[model samples]
Target: MIQLYDSFHQASKDLYYSLTQAGFQGPVVVINDDGFLPEGVTSAYSYYCQMETGQGRSLYFNQLQVPPFWEITGTNGDGEVWDYSQRKAKIFYAEPKHLRRIKNVDWFGPNEKVRFTDHYNRFGWLFARTYFNAEQKVTSRIYFNQAKQEVLVENFMTGDIQLNWQGKVYFFDNRVELFRHYFAEMGWELSEIWYNSLSTPFFLSYNSPEAGQDILFWQEGIQEDIPGNMKVMLNSSHVRTQRVLVQQRQVYQKMMDILPEEQKAKIAYLGYIYPSLRENAGRKEILILTNSDQIEKLEELTQALPDFHFHIGALTEMSQRLMAFEAKSNITLYPNISQKQLQRLFQECDIYLDINHSGEVMDAVRKAFEQNMVILAFEQTIHNRDLIPAAHRFDASQPTDMVMALAGFAASYPQMVALQREETSNESVTGYQQLLGKEER
Candidate 1:
C-alpha cells in the first residue's frame, strides 16, 4: 500500500495523519519535493537519488553560511541578508526564531530581482535550488544530493525533467512520466493506492499497473461542478478507483447533490480525527494571537465586555500601541510567548478572537478550532473564514452584536462546546476501517 500526493501541505498532513490513525501502514510518497517535508514523509526527488532521511535539525539564521562581510538582520518571522553597504542580498523565511527551521532562502542578484531560491531540508542541508527569469517567473529547478551535486533538473519552460541517477542519464517528457519511472525504479507493488489530489496524482494512478484499488481522498474545495478527473474516477470503467472520500462535509454534500444515486455509493464524507485539547471550563476567557497591533475594535470589545478576560499574545514584543491595551483591566498581554505558554493559553481560553489584521501567526485560527475554542471574527479582520462559522462572524461596525453573542456563548458554554464538537465532524477509527475494508484487530 502507498499514499501518493502532489505535496505534503497542511491538507496532505491531515489526511496522512487520519490514515495512520485508521491503521494504515504504507510508504507515503510526495511528487513535489520542497525539501522541508516533516519526518517519515518521503519525496520522489529524495527517493530517486536515495538521499538520507532528514534529521529534524533546527536551521537558525546565524547557522546559515553567507558570503564574507554580509550582515544578517533578524525580524519577528524572517531574517534578511544585506551585502556590505549594498542592496538586500537574500531573505531567509522560516518559523519563529525559537522554533526556527529554514524553509527557503531567496537570493537576489545585482539587478535586485530574485535570481534563485535555495530550498533547505529540515536536516540542515541544501537539497534544491529554483532559478527564476528576469520577470520573476520560474525557469528551472535543480535538485541536489547531500554532496551538493546536481542529481535532477526540472525545466519549467519545456516541461521536461532530466534525471542523472547512478551512471545512467534519463529524460522524461513530463512529471508524470518521471514519477512513473520513479515507481518502476523503486520496484514496489501497486497493491493499494491512496491519493489526495486530482491533478498529477490522479493521472499517475489512472496510468498505473492497474492491480491495486485506488482510493481518492478529495481534500480540495469545490468551486464549481465536480472535478473532471474525479468524474472519470467515479464513472470510468478503465479506472481502478473504488471509492472517493470527501474530507469536507460541505464539499461532500455538493458532490452528493450533483452526482446520481448510483455514483453516490462510491462517495462518503470523511474528516480528520482532530485531537481534543479544549478545556472550556466556563472561564469566559478569550485568546487572540497576533503579530501586529492592528486588532480591529479591540478596545471596544474589551471595554464592552469587562467580565470576559482577553488574553492577547504575540511571538514577538508588542508595540506601544498594543501595549496601551495593558491599561485595560480586562486585558492581559503576553509578549514573547513560549510554546508552553501558547499551549496553556489555547487550553485555558474558551474563545479565540480573530480580529487581528495581518498574516496569521503560526496557523492560530486552525489551532484555536482544534483546541475547541469558540471563534468570533469581524469580516474585515478575519484571517481564515473556513473554520469560523457564518453566525460567529460580524461586521466591523457590529461590535455590540459580537459582544452580545460572546455573552450568550459564555452563558451557555456547555451547549456551545457541544455545537463545536458536532460541527467538527471528526470521524472515528471504525468509519476509516469500514472505508478501507479492514476488520478491527
Candidate 2:
C-alpha cells in the first residue's frame, strides 16, 4: 500500500498512523515540501525533466492540468521509464482512532468528528481523495449509502445520539422530510428520530404537516422567519408549493399558531441537553461573543468594562477592530480556538456578554448558557432575551441602561450564582417524549 500527503499537519500525521496500522508499508510520498516527513519511510517528490523544462504530477500531455487518474510519462533520477498506469491503488483516509486491523472485516463509526488542520488546500485535496475512496470502508462517506441495518436518529446538532462503535448508527438530522427522503433514496428504513429544541422552523404553505409517524419531535417556542440555510434546504419542489410563512415573534410559536390543534400535540415546550458540568467558581472575568456584526460594539464594551478583565471570543478576526481592542492590557483576545479550548473559557469565566446578535443564538452563547454562566445579552438581540433569563439581559438600545445594569450585576455577583443554581436547566421544560404507536404503549 502507498500513502501520499502534504505538509506537517495533524491530519497528515493521523493519516500516517492510520495507514501504518492498515498495513501500508510503502514510503509515503509528499507532493512538494519535505520538511515534515516521517522519519523512516517518507520522501518528497518534485518534478523536473532531464531537459531544461519542468514538470508537475498533475500537468499532463503538453502541460495541461488533468486529474490524478492521468499519468505523467517521464524518467526519474534512476533513468527508468515511469509508468503511472501500472500503479493501481485505492485511496483511504481513516481517522487515527477509527482504524481497524489490516484486512479485518469489522464495522466502524462514521466521520462525525472532523480533525483536519487549517490548511484548506491540503485538506481539500484530502477530501476529494477520500470522497472517491468511499467504497473501501470510508466510514463517514460510505455509511450514508450503506446504513440499512443501522438505526438512525434525529436530534439537534449538538444533541446527536450516541452509537455503539461496532455497528449501531445514531444519525443527527435537522430536517424531518428531507432526512426521510434521503434515507428512502439510500434504500434505508427511516427507523427512529428524536428532536430537541424547536430551533428551526418547519416551513409550510398551508395548515398541513409531515406524514411520518415513526418519529418524535419535541417542540419549543417558534419565531416568524426560518433560518436562511433551512430555507435553502427546504426548497425542494415537493415542499416548495406547500410551504408557508409565519409573521409571529417566535419560530415554534408560529408553527403552533398555524397548525391544527391536534398536530400541535406532537410538540410541547420540552427539550433536553447533556449539560456542561464544568464549574467556574469565583472568577471575576467577562467574555464577549463577537462575529462580523458585533465588532464595533466589542470595542465599546472593552472600553465600558475597563477595570475588569475581558476575554473576547470571535470566530473571525476583523483585523483592524480586533487589533484596536487587543491593544488594551486587560483584554485577552482568543481567535479561532478549538472547541476544547473554548470550553475551557466557558468553564472559567464568571459572566458572558453577548452584545450584538443577528438572530440565532450562537453555539458559544448557547453552550455558555448551558454551563450556567451569567449571560448578559443585549436587548436589541431580542431573541436572546427569550434564551436567557430577564435578570441576565441588558437593553442594547440604551447605553446608560446597559452600563448601570452591568454595574449592578457586578455588585451582586453572588446573587447571579444563586439564580443560576436554583433555576432548572433550560432544556428540561422543553417537551420531549418517546414516540410510541397509535396504541400509546
Residue 52 accuracy (lDDT) in model 1:
48
Candidate 1, pairs of clashing residues: none
User: lDDT of candidate 1 vs native?
Assistant: 0.81
Summarize candidate 1's per-residue lDDT along 218-292 as a digit string, tens digits. Answer: 888887688888777778766788789888888889889988888899999888876666567777899998888
In model 1, where is the ten-residue run with the lowest total lDDT?
89-98
> Estimated TM-score per prediction?
0.91, 0.40
* Per-candidate total of colliding backbone pairs: 0, 17
Could you give candidate 2's per-residue lDDT for residues 164-223 as a string of tens digits?
Answer: 233533343323333233334334322222212122212211112433222212222334
Which candidate number would show the highest TM-score if scored against the true structure? 1
- Candidate 2 residue 210 C-alpha distance from true site, Å: 18
Superposed model 1: Cα runs more than 4 Å off: 49-51, 54-56, 84-88, 96-100, 260-262
Provide the lDDT at 5 for model 1: 88
